[model samples]
Target: MQLKNAALYLLSLSLLALAGAITYFAASLRDINSSLPQIIDTVEKVNQNIAPLVAEAADIKKQIPAILKESEQIRVSINETIKEAEKLNSQLPVALTESKNWRILVPIIVKEAELARETLNSGIQEINLVRQEIPVSITRVESLITESRNIGKETSEGAVAGVFSGALRAPFELIAGIGNSVFSIFKSEEIILDNSDKEMILETVQALINASEFGKTTAWKNPATTRSGEITLVNATTIKKARCFNFLFKFNDQKPHSENVSTILCETEQGSLEVVR
Candidate 1:
């Protein structure tokens, strides 16, 4: 009876241990069932992310031949560029030699340029000097002309008066009177201009010569002297490498006397108009 009691106790202990193991296994199964949804979601996300990678890999496979062809073209271009560089390198020595030869002429070219500059400066100085001297020269010329006119007039009047007085003393008063009357009738009318009148006339002439067209006339009057003058541009020419023009000047004095004179004026290197003839 003791042996049967021991066997029954051992069987009850085995059943209790088996029941505990079944309960633990059932709880583990429940936990696994709850995490199944998360595992499935992680798998779906991995597939979605890998889909584009697979497509890109296929595209790279398809472009491999074109990429290889383009690489071959780049290699050919690089080789051509290298060949051109070699050609330029080969010619560099000849270019350097030619440049050295050109360097030998640099001093000579600079010397010639300096000489040209000096010549230009000298010409400019000469022009300036001429320009400064123009007014003085004009005044001198006018003075000389006035002196000559006065001398001629004095000489003519003295000779005529002496002849008339000698004829009257020789008992030919009637003849002298007739000769004087004839001389008076045939004597040329003179238009005497003062210095102020001359200056006004010259200024007008210069302005007209510079600004007036051909066949145009410009006139000036001096109120102080009641003197008037007109200058007309008639013809244009070149003389001694200077631009020249012919002008006709008509002068009127206070008296009923007038005179016409034709003169030629030329432009000097100084750019001033001067009487040429």
Candidate 2:
């Protein structure tokens, strides 16, 4: 009877342990069931992300032949490059020898270039010097021209005076040939005239003859010497390519003596007026 009681107690404890295990398994299964939708959603997302990778892998697999062909071409190119590298290596000694020749010439070429640069600099300096002197030279040339003009003017005036004196002397010489008395009277008048008075008379004669119209008269008086003169343009005529004019000059001296002279003057080729004998 005691053995049957012990067997019943162990069978009841095993039943309780089996009920606890079933309860724990049911709770675990409920948790697992709760997480199953999220796990399925994550798996769907993984599949979506892996879709492009799967397509790319397929495409890469399809291009495997072309990739192998390109790789073969690359290997051929690499082989050619290596052969060229070997050829270059074989020529390196010659190249180095040529480079040595270039190195020897390089300094010479550089020296020549330096010489050329110096020559250019010298040429530029010369040009600058010429440029600097240009204004001075031009000024000198202008000064020379002005001096020449002044000299020419003075020479022309002197020549005109000389010609006029010669012409007046010729008429007087002709008069002296005719009669010594008339020449003596003219000589006496000249002797009595002051140099300044003669110059004034000559200037007035030139001015009136050059500027006055025919029959126009111009007069001058010097109060200091009581000398007076009147010049009149009477007529104009052409003679052998020269424009000629007839002028009447009247002179009065301090003694109140008066003299009248008729003179013919011509414009010479030199553009100056001189008495015509």
Candidate 3:
């Protein structure tokens, strides 16, 4: 009976040890499973958070070139506008002169035409006599134009040439136009300067000079379509005085026509002239 009781106690002790080992191993396995599932869930949430940011970075990279191209286009357009404005600024003077009411001043021009008529009329007979004897006032006109060209060239090569460099730059520059006008006047047989006409033209010329002093001279040039004139430093008087002079005369059949006259104002360096050509 003693041996059986000892054997039963040993067996009970072995059974309790085995049950304790099994319970410890089961609890450790449960803890490991719970930790693994939590780690997996954390990794999944991290991937979800990073996805939108990655997509946004890719989208910005793709749009960068388009935004840069638009910026370049805007810069180019602004430069073009600036260039156009510069061009317009260069042409504004002539454009403003051409738009004024020149025809309204014609009656005033007619009233002051007598002296110019006499000068041109008296000069006609001389021109006709020369034409009959010489046969070529046109050639003379060409010669005068050539001489003027030489003078202009010489002047342009000197210190005073700087004054005309910009004037020669306009597309419709008046330098060539003035030469053409001189030729046209010489070609006409009916345009002559008589002695009486010369006096009248001179008187009117003086009055016009006076007008240039008190009034503004806009779009007038030396030597109108059929006249001859000059501009000099001597004429650069007070802004209210004559800064330039343009003499004119008329002729019929290469003879002096004392009754007809024409006169005009010319350009000047002064500031007060109304350049209303």
lDDT of 3 by residue, 1-277 (tens): 9999999999999999999999999999999888998899999999998999999999999999999999899999999999999999988987877756566677778867977888889999788877786647455445544543454476524432332222222111123223333223334455554444344333443343433222232222223333332221222212233233333333333223323233333444432222222
- TM-score ranking from best candidate downward: 1, 2, 3
State the lDDT of candidate 2 residue by residue for 145-172, as single tens digits.
4543443455435543343333322221
Model 3: weakest 10-residue lDDT segment is 165-174
The TM-score obtained by model 3 is 0.21
Of candidate 1, the 10-residue stretch with the lowest lDDT total is 167-176
Q: Which scores greater on lDDT, model 1 or model 3?
A: 1
lDDT of each: 0.67, 0.68, 0.49
Q: How do the predictions measure up, each by TM-score? A: 0.37, 0.37, 0.21
| Residue 204 error, candidate 3, Å | 61
lDDT, model 1, position 119:
100
* TM-score: the better of candidates 1 and 3: 1
Q: Where is model 2 more than 4 Å wrong at Cα?
A: 1-33, 39-203, 206-212
Reference-based TM-score, model 2:
0.37
Give the true-structure RMSD of model 3.
26.4
lDDT of candidate 1 vs native?
0.67
